[model samples]
Target: MWAVRRASHPLRSQGYRLGAFRAASTKSSFGHDVDCGVVVTCVPGRKVHVLDCHSLPLLSAARHGKSVNGGYCLWNRGLSSQAGTESSGEESELDDGFSELENPIADTNLEAKAGEGEIGEGLVSDSELLSDDDNEDDAGENELHLSDAESEESKKKTLSEFLKVIVAAPRMKMDAALDKWIEEGNPLGRYEIHSAMLNLRKRRWFGKALELSEYSESHKLLDFVERDYASRLDLIAKVKGLQKAERYVEKIPESFRGEIIYRTLLANCVVQMNMKKAEEVFNKMRDMDLQMTAFSCNQLLLLYKRLDKKKIADVLLFMEKENLKPTLFTYKLLIDTKGQSNDISGMEQLFETMKAEGMKPDIQVQSKLAKYYIHGGLNEKAEAVLKELEGDNLKVNRGACRALLPLYADLGKADEAEKVWKVCESDPRLAECVAAIEAWGKLGKIKKAEGVFEKMIESWKKGVSSRHYTSLLKVYANHKLLAKGKDLAKRMVDSGCRIGPWTWDALVKLYVDAGEVEKADSILQKAAQQGQTKPLFSSYMTIMDQYAKRGDVHNAEKIFLRLRQSGYVGRIRQYQSLLQAYVSAKAPAYGFRDRMKADNVFPNKAVAAQLAQVDAFRKSALSDLLD
Candidate 1:
């Protein structure tokens, strides 16, 4: 659409300037200078024309057909040029007509006719201009004003060419081509390349494009296409290309750098394993004088976690120096990382800091702190954290409940553990609590752990299968309740829960712990018959330890030989147990003596000396009994 702005004129009627000009005669009956109002035609097709209507004497003389004035042509020469048909004959005819004019009215009519002819000629020229076919030779010469359809077609052509370049170029070359197009000073080219880059990003080639942009920045070519630099950084981050994303951001003009870009790039770098790059970018950001937001500061905290504790301290010092306040996410990350590293002091300090900052710990943070306390064997602190979060209603997590319940059982805090379990019972995540309860029961919190099992059964409603029953059996075996563990195993099998090697191993370990060798042997036989004795290292160690504890030299020797034959490397403790058993029997054979004397053999020197005392005592007892 063409926009027309009207120009204002002061001397004209209704603020409208007439398109015509007039010239006035200066002297009476003599050639003199004329006062002329010159009107220059501003529109492209028309020409300047002057009218001398105000010269009264000349007007009077021109009223008659004869020219009483000197050298005056009635018709405007400018009109002939406007009509596109300038000729000497037309000028002569105008002069003859001026001689024939009867009055000024005839001259006005003639001027009006010339004006109409000029407009008609302009219309004809425009039609011819539009009709001319485009050719290579005429293309530069013709300044044809584009119609809306033609402009749209040009835009489409530009966009199509740009898309072809983008699609044909490798990902690494796309940004270079885009930057080159933008540098060529074509707005359409800039828009097209920008659009193509956006599409490439959508197709999951954002990383490659980001790399190209970085290369462009290094070459000082990125300045041409920095309009959407922030958005490109965000896109690179969303696609998880942190390094390239950071490079794209570093190339962004200083005026364009803002909190959003800084935070996104910092967060991206925070999770990467490359600490050196992250630190460098972070420091560079600081040097840029950009105020780090809370999110960005938190990202630094996460980045510091992968470094040493001293480095973390340095980061904290830096944060303090920069006046960056730690947010809830920051504290949460610090607490979780410290907890994972078993840094109880560090976790406690972080918790205290949060309290000082008046930031109430959320459930996720509380869960982490509780887990840390539990790991340190500080059940009281763990329970306190849980209870604080749960409050009067005791709304602890099922997993936390399971974890804490076991700790309570170990500490004999059965009531507290039971309360936590009740809260867990109402939660839909009951199955998740099963492992926790079993863990607690195994840690000698049998009764408290049993409470969780009973809740699971009640929640399930129907008779529980062996799959469910085995967890409780495992708890029993863990607490050295061999008899109960075996009975539960049998019940589990009868209830159609297939007993695996783990179940048998648990039972055998429990029996071995209880010194029920005969029962353990029977269970082993049954396990072998069922093909459930998988000869696990721990189970073998348990049986061998049981033989050593009972002072059964012959059986211990037999088991040791069996273990070696079965590819078991007999540990020193097992060998010591054999020595004790032989000394207790008072019948140490030559082979057994030599094996015991072998240095660096099963039992070391210290254990061998202990075994010699046992042998001496056995000999004295035998002599006493004989006397």
Candidate 2:
């Protein structure tokens, strides 16, 4: 009966046929009862199959063969080859069956474990099947699903496509989309999208990308965009592309508006001289109840200086109403603009008002005030500012001293100018005193100028620099003191100062003026040996003209030939001057008279016309002798 039931069981029908039956006393090493039916399949060769006997009553009956002629026959002759043919499929089926059974068992075990917690009963735990380390290994297996090369290539392709989009798209559209993408959590979109937007801003797209990025919290996008915005705004303003910047500013929502954006828009409008638009923006800022910074107000004042004074007065009145104290920059703009317009009385009143507000005039304001006084013919007032500045602990700036020195010199107040020069000379930072010395030279106060130059040289030797020496050399050259200029030039070279083309030209001209051709020649030769070809034609002409002027026709001709040999093509006047020198320096009887006659034969008009006039008079007197 058990054999018959086993043969008819589902396991046998699926080819896991049983061949024998055992009682419950039989057991296997894995702790399952061996009292299951053993299902056997007979083909050319014999194979055995086992099943749990308790779950297969029908297979048990088939194996026992109570309804068949065989004794405990559990074998099927055709089943063996079929089982072999379907081994894989049947194995999978068996695996699914085992897994299905095990899953319930596992759930029961879990429930039992949970029940153990409630009832304090001991149960086998999942820790027996696997350790935490094995769990980690399973995680590692999951991660291995994607290889490194595949992941990396996918990332690169994504980034490349993103960059292509950014590079090809219009800047405004790209920026807008970038803002939207960043807001949507910066997902699998290319990192280069943000980077490309940043690059566009760097290429001087100014506020476009930055305005989009401002409201984003992505640190990377904000950082790159702000850095690019700051870099390009100045250049954008310089090109008068402030409208593009204004377009960016207009996109900034009220909640995201800040001092930087406001300042940028205000500056752009000012630079474009779109004062009406600037005022509208400024008024919008005020209506927004944003605290206006001192810089913003100053920018408005600058725009007003160019646009409408009434608007400036209106802004000032608004400041008063807002209880905002006018800053130093506010006063500076008003003072400077008023001074430029020659509004002396108005500037005086404004200056007094600034002082009353406890804001002392800064150096810039004082400089403008000095200029105002000087221009209005109030030299005494300008001098008073200088004297007052001198007594104050505040360092009198070089610009202020420069303005004062010329005024004193122009007023013929040499004593005061000399005093100012003394103060400037003693101060190391006020090396612009050389400018005053040069001015004194221009005013033809050569002795005072020489005195200042001597002081400058002494100061320079003690601790000053080639800058001072260069300035003094220029001053000496301006005064036409060729000997002093040449001496200073040597001092500059000996001091290890680089003899730049300007310095070398000045020295060469000085030497040429002093008829020191040999010294100039030595300098040029040294420069050539050093492979420094500068002051090219100017230096050549200096020597040529000097010799021609001194009537040294021999040296002048030598210089002219050397210039031509040296590839100088520009000095036709020098050549003509040298020719005239040749005519002038000849012997009165033979060389001078014959040279005069030969001058007419050379048909070059510039030379021929000049020589023909000279020869005409000479020949008229000497026609009798020649005939």
Candidate 3:
């Protein structure tokens, strides 16, 4: 065994750095104030291995003892290397496929609460380690008393907290924050890492996700699970394109290339409408005997259902030959195909066939059936199906309710939509509530829309996301309920709901509709003050267009300047708006045109034609003066 002593110079001081790993520490995972460290051992002749004192060496049998896929109990000991403290049998390993120098703490306290009896009854969990404000007792309560269910909950909470921290911080701070998290002995294991990746994907932040993955690998923690491959492939497809994604899949190790990755790629192809590439991938899957499920086959069927319906029959035949059993999803795809081709009878036959197979039709199937009948103008058939769904002993799902609301809204059946809304009102999902509100809004039933928004807000505090708040603001704006809208906006801000571009536009439009130009300008100014560095281009354009139409060239110019200050410049539309302002103000057009030319923005037909009219007027005035 190599007994390595600390070098005279610290690693952090020696400029030792890796992916997202830098030297900064308030407290190490061991509660010691030391920075992260690694010990390098040089073997005879050629090989050197860097190891963490707290971490087992890569080739060490202890390293393989802790599998990344296995779950471990919480760590009880602190990370301090104080004398007289021994590694406990209860000490858990990092199952995230990472072993780093552990911050070892001295034996402190190990008293469980009134009803705790697990082996790890006094350990600190990954969640506790991550929490900054958590007291010693709070940490103990979480780690010691957690049952299996609570342990799962703790893991989810830990994952959520980690994501929030990374998301809230600036990109520059992300590296330091992540390093600190790992150094604190929190598990950045497979599940946690995948959770983080999914959240990033939801935000379309694939670049950041890839950065995190690189950091994980540098820390020796990256586990290439099937989901991870699929997520990365999807990110590649989105960030690059379908062609790049195809190329990427080809480069993946043959063993790692499987159904999930193929499904993701085929899905991407369907989305991009690259039918030729889709066919190639499908054929490749078939040739490799990898197309074992109807899932992959259905994706291709979806593509053909949109383009060439004749090919869909061939796909169904291929499914039979492959012995890939048709799933409920398969029938759903077939139903959609027939519906698209206006084959109402064929759609009905598929739906009945699905039910005859003992597959209880879910809300999705019911909704599709209703929609098919509705599209065929068979109103009675649509009503019968909807009535059966709503009155069935089986609970009407939010989707079914959602479908009925839109149909009712389209037909101006406010009472019917209200019935559907009542069924969906108990749903915690904001989408269901938003759909009900929109249905009312579509029918010009302002009171009903307001009632839907209010009821949802009152029912579930978590239901009212920023989108819901924006939707309510839009309702108020549309109805010119100025006082109500202002009150709601203030409440929304006070509740700490983020105001997006749509909300900003709605607020501005409300004031503008009330003929309060200065008030609209006031709200825009307030948004800018609140750190809205970049308002929507459309929001700024709306105000400028309104000001120009009113011959308020001064205010229009102010909005134009605001857009430019917000880092939007050299756009033809912006220059055209400013040019229109000059025309309305009856100022010289030549100066504005020259400015446009300087910005390399030539006038479009509309602006050129207006300028031509202005030039003719100027010439006539000069000629009359000379006469």
TM-score of 2: 0.36
- Give the poorly placed runs of model 1, Cα more than 4 Å off: 1-398, 427-468, 474-487, 509-515, 528-535, 565-567, 586-627
Task: For residues 1-627, write the lDDT of model 1, one tens digit per residue.
Answer: 000001122111112111011212112212322111122232333322221212211111111111111111111111211111221122210121112110111112222332232211010111111111211121322377666678667766776776676667675566666567668864432334344444454344555545544544555533432234554565565454666676777677777776545654554454332344555566556666677555554554444333222123233333433445666665665565446545566467656666767888766677667766866778888778767765654452344454455445545565766666667556534544565566566456677567767777677746455546767776776677776777777766676665655566667767876778768767665665564234443455567567766777777787667655543332344455566566566555445445533421323344546556655334566788998
What ranges in model 3 sit over 4 Å off?
1-150, 153-157, 198-208, 225-227, 287-289, 307-310, 392-400, 410-412, 423-429, 454-627
Candidate 2 per-residue lDDT, tens place, 286-356, comes to: 65667766556556655544333323433442343344555666666555545544556656766776676
Which is superior by TM-score, 1 or 2?
A: 2
Highest TM-score model number: 3
List per-candidate RMSD values in Å: 42.4, 46.2, 24.7
> Model 1 — TM-score against the truth?
0.34
Superposed by TM-score, candidate 3 places the C-alpha of residue 593 at a distance from the truth, in angstroms, of 38
What TM-score does each of the candidates earn?
A: 0.34, 0.36, 0.51
Better of 1 and 3 by lDDT: 3
Q: List the residue pairs that clash in candidate 1.
A: 63-102, 63-103, 65-99, 65-100, 406-440
* Candidate 3 C-alpha lDDT tens digits along 225-291: 4545665676667566777888878777778898767777876676554555776676666556674
